[model samples]
Target: MSKDINYLIKSSIEIYFKNSQIRDISFNTFLPENRNLKSKRSKLKMEKEGKNNLRFFIESKDITAFRASINEIITFGKIFENVLNLVE
Candidate 1:
């Protein structure tokens, strides 16, 4: 593998949810999946640790839109990268 590929593999993150609240209806399927190149949403894997496991439920709440347009999103990312200190 290329050095870049190795670096990318090492920088990857894993996100696990006890139960996903991202339903099909809530998603913009046609917009495009895996569009962001920053950090992609990992495939979720669930396990039953015990029979008495607490459940995570999505409360009645609304998600605000991106608030900014696509160009703004990219601009914000670049600005954040320039100033924000991210810890590995």
Candidate 2:
């Protein structure tokens, strides 16, 4: 069974991280090809909410990894937000 169904250490979180420039920067900065990421095996689900709005669903079966991944994403988002504020 999948982690979502097994309750065997699963979690998810959503983030905007949508601006085109920010998205490009994040992609380059985060290195999606990295195999060492805690959420490497996790599934990434994304939805386009609007022109520049996106909803990200990060899911993972490894509880520790899941939390760590969320933390990492939050840090990325915080940095993005700070940069966005400066630009705007």
2: Cα error in model 1, Å: 50
lDDT of 2 by residue, 1-88 (tens): 4535454344444444546656556555545632345445465554445444445566765666566666766776777678779988
Clash count (model 2, backbone only): 0
Task: Report the alpha-carbon TM-score of model 1 versus the true structure.
Answer: 0.20
Q: Give each model's whole-structure lDDT.
A: 0.26, 0.57
Off by over 4 Å in 1: 1-68, 85-88
Report the C-alpha displacement of residue 11, candidate 2, in angstroms: 5.5
lDDT of 1: 0.26
True lDDT of residue 30, candidate 2: 48
The stretch of ten residues in a row with the least summed lDDT in candidate 2 is 30-39
Each candidate structure's count of clashing pairs: 0, 0
Question: Candidate 2: lDDT over CA atoms?
Answer: 0.57
